[model samples]
Target chain A: MSNAISLRGLEKTYANGHQALRGIDLDIKHGEIFALLGPNGAGKSTLIGAVCGLVKATGGSIHIDGHELPRQYREARAKVGLVPQEMVNEGFESVLSSVRFSRGLFGKPPAPKLLEQILRDLSLWNKRDDATMTLSGGMRRRVMIAKALAHEPQVLFLDEPTAGVDVELRRDMWAMVRRLRDRGVTIVLTTHYLEEAEEMADRVGVISDGRLLLVENKTDLMARLGRRQLRLQLQQPLTQLPADLAGFPVELVDQGRELVLDVARDNQGIADFLRRLAANDIDFKDLHTSESSLEDIFVELLRKPA
Target chain B: MNFYSIHAIFRFEMARSVRTLMQSLAAPVLATALYFVVFGSAIGSRMAEIGSIPYGSFIVPGLTLLAVLTQSVSNAAFGIYMPRYSGAIYEILSAPLSPTEIVFGYVGAAVVKSMVLAAAILITARVFVPYEVAHPFWAFFILLLCAVSFSMLGFIVGLCVDGWDKLEVVPSLVITPLTFLGGSFYSLNMLPPTWQTISLFNPVVYLVDAFRWAFFDVTEFNPMVDVAFLLGFLLVCIVIVGQIFRTGYRLQH
Candidate 1:
């Protein structure tokens, strides 16, 4: 399948000489939930802005569904929607008029039913007649989303869509995103929340210092960089490492009350270590295994120089 | 050109004006009425007629021009500037709108507004001072030309300014002072020879003179020169506005 969006050597340099993006090359597959994970000032917003034609890339080109950007910009932009990070709305405009106006801006014929459905879906139908300024911050954000989706874009870019939202509202947004993905819409989201990426993304791309560090399947990335740890709660405390298990990568924890083992090399390594502990006559009442989360891998990746 | 997009933006801007009727429509009309009361009645009774036209009638064109110029610039400037200030400009910039369509929608609404105010002022002038247009068609042509040109200038100012202070500086300080000095109250011929020659350099003077010629058939420069100057200024504004969109200056990151 062709990519929904494609970028080659995309770069941006601000007038002050700050290089925001340094040659980013990426392809987002159709119908996939792609998450771009980055820290602050990591060029995530700039990358999205370049694709949406809100920022002119200093170098390189972008294509949206085979249409070149800023040239065939009308056609290209018509195929995409952007929910910017900024929570901005027409303060004096009614919710219904705001969304309808946005739909018309794309040169699309008015579809009142579709707009109505969108408002209802976002739980904004009841507030349709109210001015945007009268709504809560979360509600205004919903209005922004409704406006973006009013044109029914094939691809949508959500730049930190859940920023400053409450936990319940964030969950609702996540569910809404899942619904959109199920309907075969391509979604590219940037997030500071690692769990959000881990929970929703089919593929994850890590970027830092204006460079894409890696792009991989979410599970594959976790498995490759993640480490597993075993915690054994011993019935008896020990002060020092046993002389017999000198070759094993194990350390005492909780002031000798538990044996912490780094079991990353192989799955069966845990079984082998357990057998060695049995041979040494070590007693344990309980044990549990823990694996490193995507957050850990993300931090580790950012720590390394590109 | 996407007419639908243009209509959408135009309609949205017009709606805002309706919502802010007190500020957008009433304020200017009331101010123009005061000018007629103070400058047309109180001051006109003591001054002699200028160039075969009543002093009260002569200042009608000037006062109308004053209102239209200032209103056109402030209306168009504020129209575009509000979007930028509120961050709603992102929707416009990201939409499939060609820069021309965006400008047309915005400037078109602003022109409509200035013309409405100009018409109201003209009707109000009839109440305070008697006047008749010698070339009614030319009067309308000059009014429209001035409105379109000044609206374009306002559009440029909207794009160039980054703060509220910068936005107010041009219309309040520069344009207002120039219009007053452009013979909005007195004809340039009444000034000393050197001052009259110097006043000719003020672009607003050409606008006022052309408009006055349309109204009373009296002019300091050829009417065609005035028209050409207005068109020339409009073309320059168009070029600068087009460049702004091309470079994504202030609109894009």
Candidate 2:
């Protein structure tokens, strides 16, 4: 089946001469939660904007369910929804009205029951009649979600959807997102919190400096590129490493208090390395192995030369 | 793109305006009445009537339009600009609503507001001056056209303006001066030939003339000129506003 969303050589350069996106190529599959991770000015927001038709692409093309954007915008936009990082609405409007009106914008007929279900799913049913301005930060974030879901689009873009929201809202939003994915809705999320991506996304894409670094399945990425560290607490604080053990990728850490060895997750032989350490007369009081985390991989990706 | 969505926004915006009915309607009505008291009746006591109409009646069109102009522009400008100002536009941008829907929602509310104020002023003016409607249909038409025309113009101004400091530029610098020199208080016919020619250049003059012609069947200029000028102005406003929405001007950035 075709991907729900696709971008080819997408380039966006603002009028101020600042390039926000540079040739980004990505495909978000149907019924998958895809997370795009990047630092500030990493062009994540710009990419989402281009897909939603909020920001015009200077070059390249974006296809939503095979419909070209900004031209077949009505159809292209009809299939996608966006939950922006910001909280904004008609202050005097009730949460229900805001969501209902949003659905109508996509030419969807009025469906109060659907709106109520969206509100309830987001835990906003009780506050449906309250002016949005009166809502708390977390509640307001949920309202944004309800508004986006009003049209029941096949694809949803959540741009840092939980950036400043509370933990409860964040968890609820993640659950709802999973439900959306289960219902065959493709989700593209951009988040600063790598843990969110690690916990929620099936596939992850990293972007930096207006460039996409990599896109890979979460588990495969961890197994393929992740590293493991074997940290040995030394029995003695003696200084240097043995010259015979120099060939191995290891380091004398904490001023010789510990011996730290880097093991490639998929390729390295930890058994041989342990034997070599024993044969080298290095004694350790205790040892433990730690796997590289998503944060570690993220930091490592950023440290790579542009 | 759909009418229901536009209607939803329209209803919400109108409800918002009505929620502060006292501040929005009463304050402006009182302010206009004060202007008539100070600038119209008080000053006119010493001055002769410019035309067959009394000075009080002469200034009514200008004063009423001034209120309409300011209120209409502020209502729309603030409605759109505030959303952007407070970062609420992002929520709007994220929604399924098209730019055209957004524009119409705002402009529709502005038209509604000016209409409300126009009606109020018409009733309020009776206490100050005994006014008659020579062409009631024409009077209502002029009121709606002016409201819609200025509201559209204001929508563009809101889109173009940036910060609060910049916001002051349009109403204070542009609208106020145009209304003042537009012949609200005095007619261009009262000016010398040279001043009259200069006053003819002011677009507000036609609006006031059109209104005067509708009300008392008396005007310093041809009614056709007023209709032509306003229609031309309305078209210009629509084109500019349409372009702004199409380009996403300040909104996208």
Candidate 3:
């Protein structure tokens, strides 16, 4: 089957000459949770807007489910939905009507049952009759999600779904996302929280400076870039490093009282390195290991040349 | 061609109007009714007649056009502007809707509102000034045309501007003043020679002339010319509105 969304040579430059997207080419598989991680002004939102037809790309071809955009726009857009970073529910419209309105806006026939299910899934059924302006911030966000889901879109773009919410709300959002993916809906999201991406993303794409730097399976990205640090506490202080262990990535620290070995998380030479350390007469009273979190890898990736 | 989307947006706008009855409906309707009471009956009754028509009855068509024009422009602006101001317009722009369907929803709702206000004013005028319509169907048709035309202009106004303060500029500073000088309260021939020439430059003059011709079969300008002018104005509004959407002027990122 074809990918859920495909973009090629996508570019967006504002009239003032600020380029928001620079030649983005990507394909998002169906029914996968893809998280786009980027800092502010990293063009994440611009990319989402272009896919959803909210922003016009300066140059590119976009196909959503095999339908080209700005040409077969109606057909292409009908298959996608967007939950923006900002909530827009200040109208006196009730939650139920707003969701129903979104369904109709997508050219869908009125489906009360589906709307009910969406509202219920978002935990907004109880507030269906209340005016949206009267709801709390979290409830309002849920209403946005419900609106996006009301049309039964095949692909959903969530921009910062959990930017500043509490832990419970964040977990609830993750659960809702998983539920949607289980229903065979593709989920593409952008977020500032690396932990959220680590916890929820099946595949991750790191973007910066209007370009995608890397796209990889979450596990593979973690294993490849996540390093392990081995710290050894020496039995006695030494002023110099052991000459026999020169081949290993070992550095003396703590005033020569300890040796720190840096290696890839998937490295298989740790046991050999230990045997060599013993042969070299290096004595350690204790040792411990720590792994790099996603945050660290992300920072290091950004700090290096693009 | 998304009829469902059109219906959805239309119904949403109508529901909002009903929800804010006092601000959207009652206040404007009541103000239009007062014009008929204060100007059409209480004030015009003592004034001299023009062209053998009672002064009270003479002002009905002009005032009706005035009511629809101002109300349609303001209502259309407000209907679309609120969503933009509150940042709810993203859903609208992102939806699978064509420009015609979107305009149909927002402008259609505004036209309906202006018609309701026009109808209310008619009823209110009947309770005060006795009036007759030589071509009531034509009157309704002209009023409908006016509503749709000005409502389209209002739609453009809503999309072209950024702030709330700018939204009111068209209805208040432009439409209201134009309608007032467009022979709404006095006959075009009553103006001084130069002012009458200047009044001809105002577009609202033709709208009032056509509407009054529908009511009394009497027109200050040639009836055919006014009708042609009205159609031309409607075409201009439609073209400008279409351009606004096609270019995504202020509606897109």
Overall lDDT per candidate, in order of appearance: 0.91, 0.84, 0.89
Q: For model 1, state the Cα shift of residue A215 in Å.
A: 0.3
Candidate 3 stretches with Cα past 4 Å from truth are A233-238, A242-248, A263-287
For lDDT, candidate 1 versus 3, the one ahead is 1
Question: What is the TM-score of model 3 when looking only at chain B?
Answer: 0.96
- lDDT tens readout by residue for model 1, A1-306: 557999999999988899999999999989999999999999999999999877889998899988888889988999899999998958899999999999988888889999999999999999999999999999999999999999999899999999999987799899989999999999999999999999999999999989999999998998899989999999999989899777878998899999988887466588888998999899999999998989999988888887
lDDT of 3 by residue, A177-216 (tens): 9999999999999998999999999999999988999999
Query: Per-residue alpha-carbon lDDT of model 2 for B1-253, expressed as tens digits?
Result: 5787688678767877888999789999998888778766677677787667888877777788888987888788877787778776664665557767877888998998999898898778878876788999988888888888888877887788887777657766878899888888777766799988888777888898899889879877788788888889889998887788677888886
Q: Considering only chain B, what TM-score does candidate 2 achieve?
A: 0.93
lDDT of 1 by residue, B169-210 (tens): 777898889999999889887899999889978999999999
Worst 10-residue lDDT window for candidate 1 chain B reads: B31-40
> By the lDDT metric, which is better: model 2 or model 3?
3
lDDT of 2 by residue, A123-236 (tens): 789998899989888888888888888999999999998898778878888889889988989999999898899899999999998999999999988887788898889888
User: Native contacts recovered by candidate 1, as a share?
Assistant: 0.79
Top DockQ model: 3
DockQ scores of the candidates:
0.76, 0.40, 0.77
